[model samples]
Target: MDMFEDDTPGNAPEFTVSELSGAVKRVVEGEFAHVRVRGEIGRVSFPRSGHVYMDLKDDRSVIAGVIWKGVASRLETRPEEGLEVVVTGRLTTFPGQSKYQLVIEDMAPAGMGALMAMLEKRKQMLAAEGLFEASRKKPLPFLPEVIGVVTSPSGAVIRDILHRLRDRFPRKVLIWPVAVQGKTCAPEVARGIAGFNAMTPGGALPRPDLIIVARGGGSLEDLWGFNEEIVARAAAASEIPLISAVGHETDTTLIDFVSDRRAPTPTAAAELAVPVRGELLAWVAEQGARLTRAQTQAVETRGRWLRDLSRALPRPETLTEGPKQRLDYLSDRLPNALRGLAQRRRVTLSERGALRPALLRGRLAEEGRRLEALSARLRPALDRAVTAKREALGYRSDRLSLRPISRDLARQKGDLAETLARLSRAGEADLRRRRDRLGAAERMRETLGYKATLRRGYVLVHDGEGQLLRSRDAAAAASGLRLEFADGNLELGEMPARPVEEGGDPAASKAPTPQKPAAKAPRKPAKDEPPSGQGSLF
Candidate 1:
């Protein structure tokens, strides 16, 4: 057994370290170069030169790997520890260290089996944070001034978005390109969103008013980077509004859940950014038609206002001044009416004054004339009546006076005629007759006287009392006696004797005395006397 092991034909003899490394390098470059392998990543490091260094392994074995700066920068993501990946690179060996490893160029997810496990875990964490809630989503702006886009720079998604936006609305657009998948793809997407926000410090973007994250259609494992919590939270915290257009219609990511708006694809996301050009042009035409109608209505209002102003202006003089004309007419008529009334009153006053005085004076003069004529006519008749009464009285008085005187003259004439007739008839005889009558008358007168009676022989005797003796009884005896004879009276010397008583003394009584007797003439004797009639007998 020792002799066979030492003299081995199939196995070569032992050499220096450089010779061993030289052989492995030839094999790696020649035969097993440019191959793809599936493994999990472990022990990752990014050096200062921007190259990525890590290990690729399975549960049984491990391998070293390197990605250069230029190639790694072009990768969709960085490789990490414990991540399942598909690496596209060639096996290589370092001659200085005498080590054999992998030089990575490109990679992808390992498989559906590995990707599903990681996606399910990340989806649960986002759901717990409420990022998948429908309520957290924002509505898209109707008209945006700036629009944002996120995709690979060389992808068809960005070209399609620009074409649609320029045609619809010529507003601005901003781009933030990032890797959409692999180990470090979530962090790169988050950085792209953050960079877009940083360009607008005060929420004013230089490129977009709204943000859109976009990519072409892919499998669920390829879209896993958008489902990461870091990418979702970056989208949610963006000040600008976010729109997600990640993959195909069936693709739903955590970024889509937190975005302000979600579109089914990249083309649809462009439509949300602006309006349609054809519809906007039509709307402008309709507003022009409305402007024409308003102008016409304003003209009609002005015309009506002018018509009303014309009606309100002042009227003509002929229509408005009727009252003033009536006032002038009354003014002209008033004075004449007053003057006519005054003249009528003056005439009435004169007529009444003249008629009253004329009537009174005429009556007075007529009455005076009538009274004077009546007085003159009565004076002659009164004078005639008075003269007639006086003449009648004088005639009656003369008749009475003449009757007495004539009666007296007639008686005297009768007496004188009777005397004359007697004288003529017997002058002597008449004388004698007259003498005889006288003598007879003388005788009769003598008979009445005592002395003449004595001549006729008559005597008277008286008693002593001197009374003619009518009776003896009436004489006193003692009284003296008286005797009357035809021629004279005789006184007795003593009382005549009387009869007495016989016894008386006769001597003492009266004595008889002698007295001369009265002388008597011869008396005529009466026939009856006796012869002794010489003495008174008794």
Candidate 2:
């Protein structure tokens, strides 16, 4: 019956044990506003309302736990019986049932189990999303101008990426620095990727040819951000080809599953970013050697062809029948019949001996005569042959000139007319573009016009030659001029004269004021840098 004291065990108070338990719970609840309990889950139940009911137990005792529907639905993994759990909750007593229960705000399985459960849950979720599919992966571009990197700013991952990309091909690499761990990290990583995309000139992001999302080697928990659904979705949704390098060769993540390519390490990711510089150089050198060898081969082939051609052709003088005819007659006449042959031989021998002198004299005289005749005939024949050949060549050249080098020039003319028409159409299109640009410019000018401000209240004045008079010095001697106000413009009348003592008197002067000899303005130098404008002549 006493509030603070215990009575004898057998001769107990009239109140039930449940009543006492409820009373004790109420007292403890009033004493402690919030409490954290570590225990093993005894039993678990989920209801249609989305609430979770579980009993938290120790070796000797247990207490009821009520997880609200909203919080229960958000848990990555469901509570199971016999699992050790840590719960932050408030205690309250139910007076009607004379029982005590905990209303849990947040809960988690204790130690390694919690992490393993989370990892397994994430793996299942991403798997269900088909993030691991190979069909979704895109091909990496051969050459890229800008490559986006999502990683820690100060880490070796970024430095490795930069060095690798520069080594492979010197191109710009944009970095999207992000938090890679803790509760807020997944969202931050996701947002960083989106931010990189948003900075592009078009609605599309800079669209780096490749995205290298990398981090140094770490334990499974340390690389957990890459396993998050947010990060996985971000990688999957990226337009750029993504290479995920989350952990060591043994470790993998959901981001790796969704990425276009996966590398075992951060350095390997860099390797994926660009080709090896030494290999490229070696390839270029090999190509150069091949080209040189090819050229050398071509030259040798041409030289051999020339030698063969020289061997195959005959000399020019041997081409006609003049030498062959004389040789043939000598061969034929020397072998004739016997009787005639003897007489012919004797006569031929004597005759040949005697006739040699006469023949030489005759030949000399005939040669001289022939020479004289040739000399006499040479000028006219040469002139005639030359004139005939020249005339023939001229006629042929004229005929060739008259022939149409280009087939159907009339048709070409018609085609040219059509082309001109097409060009005219193209010119009209260009003119329309220019006109659009002019209209846009005019609209912009109107939009930014100072005249609008001038209409509010403004004035502009000009001298005789329409030069804007900016200062009182310009207005000093100027008389005939115009002034424009917001409303309208008016021409100015003759101004009053200056005092004679100040300079020259106007009205009292008898002769017309000698016009101050106007200084001739200097001529602009000609921009006659020759031949630079010719497109191909230079």
Candidate 3:
């Protein structure tokens, strides 16, 4: 009848402090094996071991809460001081601390409305700081040499982006893996953005010309981290142009406003980042053709003008007529001058003969002999001069004969050189174009392959016979299964039976209810596997 009867010291069974604590822990854990507690968080602390310790309090009572490192990392929303949250976990006593605490497994903000309100408040604060100002936004690069991505390494979002980039244009993508929608999401995303900006432009890790902050579509609560003030501020302060692709088209976050550009989806962000390589190559070819045509037309027009000017100029014969006439006049006067000299010499000889007969006769004989000798010398000299002149004329004629052919050869050589240069340029252009196309094709093949999909967190499930299992029912029915991940394969034993709910209606249970298979841990893609996406012109 008395509750204190068991407390009698003489009849009571003894227990050490350890046993008492252990018993208390078991009872408490069993009673609260699964519970959901809604309260405001306070005194939140993240220890060096990565566990979170916090106090969950209501208006009247406070409860100590603890999130293990793994569970804390998986929380959709972090337990922050002054944040209204709902946590699900089991309650157990920490014997050393002499207190009962909640071992939280999952946590989230109280409601979507509450999260949105918080998001709005943060947005307002960032706006006041001018982080969302249009003036602060940088223009996206027309062609980014390297694109930095802050996103989950294993998600459909990354795959979509890579695939889209490959379809449009390929660029070097540097991925900074982070939690997209969890307790560490904001900080990790912010860190990724900052880390990219911190890199040296041409260092071992090349700096990205553009940045993309991306995540898949989720509920407002799941996407709340993008609305955090830290993320917004980081995006605003980034030196590299950033594109925000937090969620679907309608799901806007603070990052969307602060980033240089906002894309409706991750794929859209990739599409905006670079130009299609094929199209760029085509454009280059078009411009080159236009240039060639313009040059050819200009050359033709100049040549026509030169021909017209040549026709309008005087002839070579007309230019040489004066010199020809002067030469002819000199030739005609030479014979008359020689005849006058001969007549003058004859008159002088007659006068000398009349002065003295014998003396004059002897003198005349001497004069005649001297004149004959002089004439002989003059004749030989004239013959030599004629021979020399003939040889000189032949030499000049021979030189003249070769001049035209040499000039023609020089002109042909110049034309050939110009042709060869043009051909070389064309060849280089073609080679460059082919190389770009080959690269694009290779990237396309990679992007379109199943390996890329696997890297995006998809797994191919196979039955014992190695046939692909498409449905959850098929997988559940299979005796043995194999899962092919991006990096490796996992062989699974028989599927476990689903536990029937107690006190449930049998008829209701008999109705076929579709069940989804549990998701497996994602594996990173093998290094040997090619990355997704085609190439674009930078």
Candidate 4:
């Protein structure tokens, strides 16, 4: 054991590895309780645990540092490799590794030069990632129903925005309170943008159509929160058009590079959100007046052209003047023309006469003799025809008689009566047969009824409501029972107790104690007959 031992230092107390590390940790933390280290970051790492681990180094010396999950999330700026930062924290030891490191509580860019350099580096990275692409930016709403402003609620920025909006066109504004320039500013601003986007559009708290991220003018360090990568990404990803108004006109941040629009100040953002109501109304009135004048002139022009076209047409009476003159001339010459024509026709008839007076008398006498001869011949023929017709009529009258007709009618009447009598007998027999069948069916139905079963010593037990109690348990549970027999129905006031077994006392087993069934309202009788027009039961 002596050979394995090392030379001991003088006046030194023994300590385990944990004990030594703990002592060194206490000493370093006591000496540098609050320190500000200025160095460029190296080998930065962010784990899924949300803790940030990095190396703070200058020319030759390097110290390991860590910002825990809580501090990391609230930090306005992230630790980046090669970025110069001023860290405020206390020195502490890692006992597990027997080494010392800084437990950083706060972190920021070292100076204005470092901040601008960090901003330019971040801008280049985001630009390369297409976050600043013009195509991704949404167009601003011409007039938003609700405008959301993300800024400090107590700050002058919100008041300025509200005043500007009211002066132009009044709109509902949703103010998301946030710290504008601190460790929590970036996270709060990012969350505010996301919260507005997450709201349901037509809900009780209406979603804003346009979002304005605003803050009062401040130095570059005060405005550094808006330059955070998280805030820039949130602004770029907003579905609602976002306007960035973080500082004065000369001031710009990473958010302005990615936002849909950029305003110089909060008031300017409000102006961009809406237009003057009075000016809009004036423009609309002017357009309406111009449309009215154009319509009136068009109608008047059409009327004047129609009036000019009508001047070329002639008068109505002139169209019929020639026809009336021809009618008058024809009326004047009609009677004289008719008289002349009649005189010419009479002369023509006298010149062309076929017979003289003597010849005419001879032809008349000859025609009279011819007519008399025809009359003399026709009279004899007519008399003979009359005699033959008389004979034919007498013979026909003798041949036709009423006796045959009367005989035929009498025979038909007798046959009809016999047929009617046969039909009556057949109808009566059919009715009797049907009556016998129906009677047999009625007797069979009665034989097959429940009363027959009762007569054979099977009693039907029914509950108070007339439903059959088919089991012993059911009968025992019932309040009252009806015993239906062939003779009559008997009602019991109460359900009987369970009967004893054969091996029990003979007296208790002898009979079920008679239960006085409780009085119950009687149920209506059920229908017995089937519906009409059904097929024969048989």
Candidate 5:
């Protein structure tokens, strides 16, 4: 029978385009509801809706395929042109285009060996471009004020990282949530790294001093996103120091090679970002003590030198004593010497007058004239002698005077004393400053100690084996436990039950103010409980 032949006008079968298309869709979709197809991808395209459309083809046949946005986002590896892959999806028909296609739910490389080869090839290509060069790597910051984290927020990886950071040194963490292992992981992580670098420093949003791209331990297929070239390039080009912590210590990814630092795990990455506050404080205190000691020793040495120099210097009175004695002797002898000279001249004149009257008169006149001339010359000679002696005495007096020496010595002593005073003042000031710093550091250390926290109404619960309890479950399971209060400890048989109130509201049961524990006799252990070791609360 001819199926399309119209036998009669009234009895002819008719159908709308929608009815025909719906029938075809049902038949095609039912036949290939669930199937796996192996082919090389071709002409892959993404539209505004994020759906991936592509052609899957072999030498002899071709088929159209699509991955919806939600499913496409979850793919571990994205589809690439000419790449052989195995895709699992359901076959469906689009009524508008009158075509049949596979709606891909999942995809993977055709083989593990093929994927490895591709990864190695990509690594080689990136290496050739100097992306993995040692010179390209930047040094990680010793202390980062703001740390940027790229990871999945819902995963345990971020929580582990934050906990580790808090334990070491608390820092501001900016979390950029992204897929850690999927088709979108590479692009999202790359964007996150670049976004941190693009932020302006000291702006409304603090720029990260360090970036950590982290993911938990995963299989090679699951970690492949971190090995993508895009992620590697982004890490290499980051202005801020980048740390790649993609998997466990044994795992290595391409981004690890390109990053400035590679941490064995996400927690280790957080450790690398900042220094421990306690250790840093200890170091500062040590340095301050050393400085104070050095300055004090220097001041003491200088003071000793000044004392020795002062003892070696001559006194002003000792230097002037000789000149003063000579002046006194010269003053006492001058008048007696002049008197003896005048008496001898008078005796000579009397002897000449008694010789003759006429002749004596003439002789007396000549003698008187000669005596007068001699007297004139003698007086000048005496005066010159006195003047020469006076000048010599004056010269000696000037040379012996203590004023010049005292002035010079005083100036030198004043300068030395001033210098010493300044040095002493400076050393004392520096010592005081260093001591203050050391004290402050000690206070800070005490403040940050766990004992201080315990005093604030917190307690430390330890098991019978001396292991600290971290959770309520662990505390409940222990056979015997020690409860540490601020002042002392108590041995308990088991975890204490919470006290209830009449209203059944937990908040209504108020705890009494903490007080010093009173001394008490040791209680005998219960039948099921083990004896606990006794220790100080601290």
Candidate 6:
């Protein structure tokens, strides 16, 4: 063989890590499909995930066991360290860890011996806690008016109890049906006991006076539910007196130790709950007869004693004779006492009548003096009242706030300023409007007046008194003629009226002849002169 022979690739088979692990898992699970493992529990773990993990081991070999969350809660007996248990489940492998484990579907104590050992151990633990103390037990009622029974309704235990109770004394019974075996038994029984105690007294449903937790005879394994810690504590904590009749005389449970009374059987528990009705009625009748006889004897004894005491006492007539004589003595003196009282009252009335007028005058004078004194005090009192009122007014004034008045003043000031500004603006606007109207009227007057003609090389003739001279006759008859031009006025000397003969031309004769004529000068025209060379309208 060549040395490189081992280096050559060979065609054995192709396999992945996951495929190999899966094949191994299938083989292990198929071979041990369902198994019952018997071993002592070594380690117990209850993680927050609710699944239970434990180690089941023999002397040498150990196996990891897992109870899923769902199955863990339904289990009757929870796994504990050092407890021998038989677990029923299938074998499975975890590919991630590459190890095999048992998935526990059901679990129980390995045998009767294992159950007894666990029970004894639990018993000792509870006994150390004072739960089994006699002081914790309550006294059973003499004859409970209402009885609460906790048991399976379909079971023979409840029927036997009812029959026994009826034969003895019929009572109102409240039945709280509960599971009596398996995983549900412990919690249901605990709840039943607690429920009976939680009822309200004198309510629509009367609260039971006593509670009886009963079950039919069974093996220790079957009755193990009563031995649970919850059932035992519920029995110890019951407020109502409880009678435990869980099994036959030979059977014992944790409840037997904590309950107030224990009966050998359910029927015996019923007997303990109530008294026999016929016996009770007969006893009551016998007590009544005895009481009646005692009452009659007592009456006769007291009557004889009263008779003996009567013989030693005085007679009735003798007792009244002394009182009658005393009453006659008192009646004879009453009229004399009344007459003496009337005489004293008459003497006192005469003395009071003699002094009536003087007493009235003295009273009037005293009253006048008192009135004057009161008047003297009244003015000062009034003055003091006024002074107090003024001080109070001053104090209140000091406490008054000025901010509101200041704010009002500021607001009024602002309003006044706004009004003044509005008035000023209104006055300015009115003045501007009036000025515009006035300017319009002035322009119109200039356009329609004689001064417009005077500006265009024409003049106006007026008399010295400032009246217009329309014709030459008026000018000649005036003392003086004034030539008015656009720029200024020039005065002419007095004009002589020429004589007009009746036939000569009157127009020529009316022409003026002034002693001294005013020389006219051409005045410069205004800036707004008409177009050059335009003839004057005059």
Q: Which residue pairs in model 1 clash with each other? A: 146-208, 146-209, 147-208, 454-486
Superposed Cα deviation of residue 425, candidate 4 (Å): 99
Q: Candidate 4 has which clashing residue pairs, if any?
A: 492-517, 493-516, 493-517, 493-518, 494-516, 494-517
lDDT for predicted candidate 4 compared with the true structure: 0.81
| Model 5 steric clash pairs | none
- lDDT score for candidate 3 against the true structure: 0.80
> Candidate 5 on 442-517: residue-level lDDT in tens?
9997787766777799887887666777776777677667776767767765434453544687666656655545
- Cα-based TM-score, every candidate: 0.39, 0.44, 0.45, 0.53, 0.48, 0.53
Question: Of the pair 3 and 4, which is ahead by TM-score?
Answer: 4
* Model 1 C-alpha lDDT versus the unseen true structure: 0.72
**lDDT agreement with native, every candidate:** 0.72, 0.70, 0.80, 0.81, 0.82, 0.83
lDDT of 2 by residue, 219-248 (tens): 766776777777888888887788888878
C-alpha displacement of 140 in model 5, angstroms?
1.7
Candidate 6, residue 347: lDDT: 62
The stretch of ten residues in a row with the least summed lDDT in candidate 3 is: 529-538
RMSD (Cα, Å) of model 6:
39.3
Clashes of each: 4, 0, 5, 6, 0, 0
What ranking of all candidate models by TM-score puts the best one first? 6, 4, 5, 3, 2, 1
Candidate 2's displacement at residue 354, Å, is: 75
Better by lDDT, candidate 5 or 4: 5
lDDT of 4 by residue, 1-538 (tens): 3322546666345678877677778788899899999999999998899999999999999999999999987776788988999999998888888778999999888888888888899999999999999998899989899999999999889999999888999999999999999878998999999999999989999999999999989898899889999999999889999999999999999999999999998889999999999898998999999999999888667655644543443443443345445544654554455445555654554567746746655654565455556656755775576567556655654444344445755876898999999999999999999999999999997887765556789776777766677677788788778776667668776655564454778475556555554576465343453212222222
Winner on TM-score between 3 and 6 is 6
